[model samples]
Target: MDNDRAFMLSHTFLLKSVKPFGEGLWQPGASGAPWRSDAAEPTADDCVCSIAIFTEEPGTIDLDGTSVSLSKGSAIQLRSGGRFSVQSGSGSATGRLAGWLVEFFVFRFGDSRPIAGGFPLLPYHQEIAVHPFAALCSVVDRITRTADGYDDPTALRKQAALLELLALLMENQQRSHMLDNAAAAVKRAISYVRDHYTEPLTVEQLASIAGVGRWQFSELFRRLTGKRPLDYINTIRLNRAKELLLLTDDPLREIAQSVGFRDEYYFNRKFSRMFGCAPKSFARSGKTAASRQPLLPAAKQARVRSSLTGEPSRLVVCGGILGDVLSLGVKPLGAELAVMGRQVVYRDKLAGILDVGIGGDADTIAALQPDLVLLEKEGVAASHFQSAAAPVVSFRRTEDVTVRLRAIAALLGAEREADEWIARHEDAASSMWNRLRSRIGTGETATVLVQIGVQLFVMGNRGLAATLYHPRGFSSSEGAAKLAEGSERFREITAEQLPGYDGDRLFLLFSGDERSKREARQLTETSAWQSLHAFRSGNIHMTEAKWNYDDSLTRGQLLPVLPHILSSRI
Candidate 1:
């Protein structure tokens, strides 16, 4: 990589009031609004030429040798790769005061810099005047109303109005327009390629997404991202493929198709060139894209890149999703996983790893020096470690465990481990099915009953029910289904309704609390409990009271003893 591309740096948003403009998703030709944000500092930009028009001032943009005051109605322009440290005091809208002072991130692509007029624009961070500011505001308001969501006539109107504003601004000596109104066009297209890379991606399709001509989008995308349109698509696809290569045992053809390379051979050649090694070798050795990335960046900076030492890299997991990544056999930098209700008992698996509290201080986390920081959600307190030291990711819990599992697998460079575990699980599950198929038929109904002190509950997709019956296709009793219908996991019920929840098979899950145990022992002895056919006919089983929580680690443990427990041996 060239020095310009390799050493390139950008500013990031620390805090912003900029919601998704124009229909909640950013696309080309859509207009943006003036935003009131509280970004204390910056590390990267939105990969665009930014126009910061300050309507109010509480922030200071720090430069190498000086500081720039973001005074009222003053505007500053920053290009791609420009870095600035700013502190905005969450501006206000009280009585004649503007709620937001800045409207930023416009005219992104470099092609727009050479305007039709010889406008020099103002010096960077020197605070310049913007004439006809109200006219600029009117054009932006029209854009918000005009651009709906696609390549329609409304979008044309929005784009035209925005271009008119750009042209007017370019006429000013302090500000010049770049590429007419195609400022954010290329960045939007690049973002589309990143998000939807798995789909059928072509230059023409991306251009359409950007609302630009095929040739125009192609040329501009190359200039901004430093790769051809198709090449950029391939970069995303094969990068994901490398993850799957390490994470899944699926066939090459299937992996290829999954990552958008229908032809396995073509993918193989590209992978070889990109990584300097074949796919199989890479997976077996757990080689990452870092084997070919600029070593200085990954080594010198903490940007969530992998280590070449041939093992899962050290990680820092913040939030409750610790179990998801832990189940992949990847040890994190922290001491132990966070303790939520009922999950404290499963902490033994984190034997070698140190246990860190969920609310660890920011300084302590930075001292641990994790390579990647995984947040359960975007609002995790651990996000403070997102500096030049480590990359912080918010891995939200998705509907599918495979999506979550595969993503974490790639991140930790545990693809082989993941693939092996998955294959082993499939085999065990299949064997279990074959063993019980003769005994448990398709017509059989299974229901999980929970006892916690005086609380009687029914289980749904969360606890043992998801493992025992959801994938196994066991039917829920009429009452059990009805009881769990309103809840995603467990629903508490009255003791009088326990008999109605009984199915062909009954599993007793306890909360393990003292009150639950005492109440359960007393209740099971009652005639009301013994009246159920499943309870009296040797079809009832006792399950681990504490393993009812959802997570990959707990689920993996359940798979091993599942058949034995189902046979009433437990």
Candidate 2:
């Protein structure tokens, strides 16, 4: 379809300006520029509606506080009395924005007005593929090309075209609804929440997991579960808390953070609401969680017992626990070392360490014949290692990671060193925050972005983003919060969500993986990548994956280097 011909009659929807069913100057506007729309305020007396179609490049439409991306061939419903603007995908001259726009006003004809409980329409600002594209083109062409545009024949023709378009939209919306239902996208999101409920969760992150919009996901979840997403997450946490209360004797505060609730008072209230009493009262009642109970009685129950008199006299580290042990100044006698993969970050620091290959090569472990073995409780370390040459200990999974590190330190006779290191880390973070706080101010936000393969992840509280969220550190950007505070440490977001992560500064982590690096390079070339606030302000910096995450040694090393990265932004 020719954009010029379609747009010439585009003014006053249904081709040509006419207030056929209403008493207002219905106007149609067309835009094909590669730029952002200025913020427009809606008039109180006039209620307007329009449909915008992407013709060239996709851009984001900010309606009120919500941001949604519109892709090519996709259209969105625009209503009056709401905050609205169309933002270019990026600032580059190439890949400029071009789209079809139609706007109309309804001032009421007599007592006529739009019907109430109107078809349970979709939430505002959401984009959808318009089906029957050929039919819509036909209708628009007929209405606009007519020589007698304002005659009775023209009016009748316009009304019919309007109805046809409405029908097509209704049909298209249903198709989208059915797809969402069949996918059970909300159910998948619920599972992600249940698993990672311990981390701070946001609706955006959950919706992304489910491959749906945040608004639609919330609505469908409420319809299916009869509760809000946050309410459901709380229920899951409470149930886990109940099981812990019955099975273990961990403290209430510890249990609270363990289950994802950061506030004890809030946890107590929700617990009472769900189980009819406080966490303590629930635990004291000796009530077992009915659902998590084992189906069959056990023939034998085994416990992980320690045979060591003290920390292993000679330590052999295995698996991903390399960073934790290395942080305490204890050199592992033998560890899984490699040039790529998990050990890549620690390569330069761990030069001469005996390469044990991957965690537990029974032959290698036996060959090292170390006095003690420190390993994770899940894999080889958790397995029966009686046949190995050394005694093994597994780190307990808990809310406080430092607890395990401290235990290891005690065994290695580096208690003072560990304490000193902790003090140094804390002091350095505090000093840096204090020095930068005056310039950045409180609530100034920053976001850390990570790309692996073709996927882009917003790094959450588990990495450098977490360190920056110190007491005096910078606040997380709105979009960044969805990932940083959510269940997953990293979340994949659509290009439209880039604005949500927009802030004063952005940290991009490159792991030196060819696929990810290649994709990352391609991303920077797009208009969407060029248009970012950080990119425009020159506040985006390239760094390694290790510095952006929550690993202690990596973060400690990063504390000093980060100031230099932010020097320009500050």
Tens-digit lDDT track for model 2 on 52-73?
6554555555566565555545
Off by over 4 Å in 2: 1-313, 339-348, 377-381, 384-386, 389-391, 395-401, 410-413, 484-486, 493-500, 512-522, 568-570
The whole-model lDDT of each prediction reads 0.56, 0.60
C-alpha-based local distance difference test score of model 1: 0.56
Best by TM-score: 2
Candidate 1 residue-wise lDDT, 24-102, digit = tens = 1112113322122535322223323444554443334445445454544445554433444444422112233221222
- The residue-level lDDT of candidate 2 at 403 comes to 45
Q: What is the lDDT of residue 405 in candidate 1?
A: 66
User: Ten consecutive residues with minimal summed lDDT in candidate 2?
Assistant: 299-308
lDDT of 2: 0.60
What are the C-alpha RMSDs, in order, of all predicted structures?
28.7, 20.1
Q: Once all C-alphas are superposed, what RMSD does model 2 give against the true structure?
A: 20.1
| Candidate 2 residue 505 C-alpha distance from true site, Å | 2.6
